[model samples]
Target: MIRAVPVLLTWVLAAGPAEMTPLVTEAVIQAPPEELWRVLTTAEGVLKLGVGAADIDFRPGGLLRTAYDPKVPLDSEAAIHTEIVAYDPGRVLVTRIHRPPKGFPFMNAYARVWTVFTLTPEGKGATRLRVAMVGYGPDEESQKMKAFFEKGNAWVLRELQAHYPGGR
Candidate 1:
């Protein structure tokens, strides 16, 4: 006679080491630096890149809000809010996500996180775009958030690459 025993299966996923470090991703966009900068700074350009509808105030100490639903108001529950920390025309743009949507995972944990886009002319009619996400703390939540942004940013860059004219 044999007795059946119940078996339980569990899986746990982690974002690896808790060290505070910046996650950097880069891509060579087949567009001029000025055009790439416009894509990074303008609402229409962002919409073309498929991130969602954007309401961008492209300046230092300005607001950048994005919502998937165009009908939603900028301050509505569906929006993601970030502050423009700094910008150098056709060179760099820095933004910090100070207010993520309510109930978002690790929302409170991202108070210090920043996303920076740097562009440089890579020769005739091409630009090198580098994105760096910084200010992740040494904690599970921060690590998880960092990993999430790393993937998300990579997708954005890929989208930019695909959307730009002459990009392959």
Candidate 2:
């Protein structure tokens, strides 16, 4: 039997009570919401983004976990613990990262972070894809950590684009 691993959900308090600093990006996909949603909710689908393991339940209060390859050169593992904070089939998918993977320094030092994706209809055959991430960090170093993710998210979507023809 294929044992299911818990997926990472979104974390709303990573930095404390400070205003949520969000990194937002949007894309217009030729595919329908159903197609996009399918890819986003699948394990293989999310792996294409160059991250670690991804398993999300797609339902509220469900388990969500994402882990990166230890072989990667990045200082932090690609793993992120989260749960299905919210979901709207064919519309929005949101996950909050609660647990950071092992060997990741400073995993327990900050508030939590949450990621949200919204799909809007843009006509007869187009979909507007909006991805946003909000998390907390206590000190400047932590803030910088969040900043790193702010920038990395762009590349994350770019990787996603590669899966989409003409993304490069």
Candidate 3:
């Protein structure tokens, strides 16, 4: 009765932006965390994701880069820009993407994105690996990216699992 309609609209407006649906995935590997950590911190391992040409320093704030041509397939790229945001030996590795050359025209149009990987030791010579990534863009566009990361992480887990001493 006393401007109740206005009050309801104000409450809805104050709810703020919707929570982002984070892209996450996990895998259990027969390899030790140390072995997995090495691959996670190196350039050769980075190539598997089709991210970019990598020059990884493997330390906190260390340089991580990948380069690729915008016109060609991403895997053929010669360079891509990335930075090491966090590096916890044998446990976690996180990086902020600077400029992604391969994912252009669709995935990496807006703000920067970050990827984090956590490795937990499991009983009897096994490890639990988790990957979490966040990306920014309009909801419609971001959804496509979310799906990409989901599939990519799945492929990564499969590849890593195969690399284990005794295949699963």
Best by TM-score: 1
TM-score of 2: 0.72
Candidate 1: residue 93 Cα off by (Å): 0.9
Error of 2 at 139 (Å): 3.5
Please give the lDDT score at residue 150 for candidate 3: 80
Q: Could you arrange the candidates by TM-score from highest to lowest?
A: 1, 2, 3
Off by over 4 Å in 2: 1-15, 70-78, 105-110, 135-138
Write down the RMSD of candidate 3 (Cα, Å).
Answer: 10.0
- Model 2 Cα shift for residue 63 (angstroms): 2.1
CA lDDT of every candidate: 0.75, 0.65, 0.65
| Runs off by more than 4 Å, candidate 1 | 1-20, 166-168
RMSD after CA superposition, every candidate:
14.5, 6.9, 10.0
Q: Write the per-residue lDDT of candidate 3 for residues 86-141, one digit (tens) a residue.
A: 66678988776655555365443324456778999997889998887754445676
Candidate 3 shows a clash count of 9
Error of 1 at 106 (Å): 1.2
Q: Between prediction 1 and prediction 3, which has the larger lDDT?
A: 1
Q: Could you give candidate 2's per-residue lDDT for residues 13-42 as a string of tens digits?
A: 323554366768787766677877877777
Number of the top-ranking candidate, with lDDT as the measure: 1
The TM-scores of all predictions, comma-separated, are 0.82, 0.72, 0.69
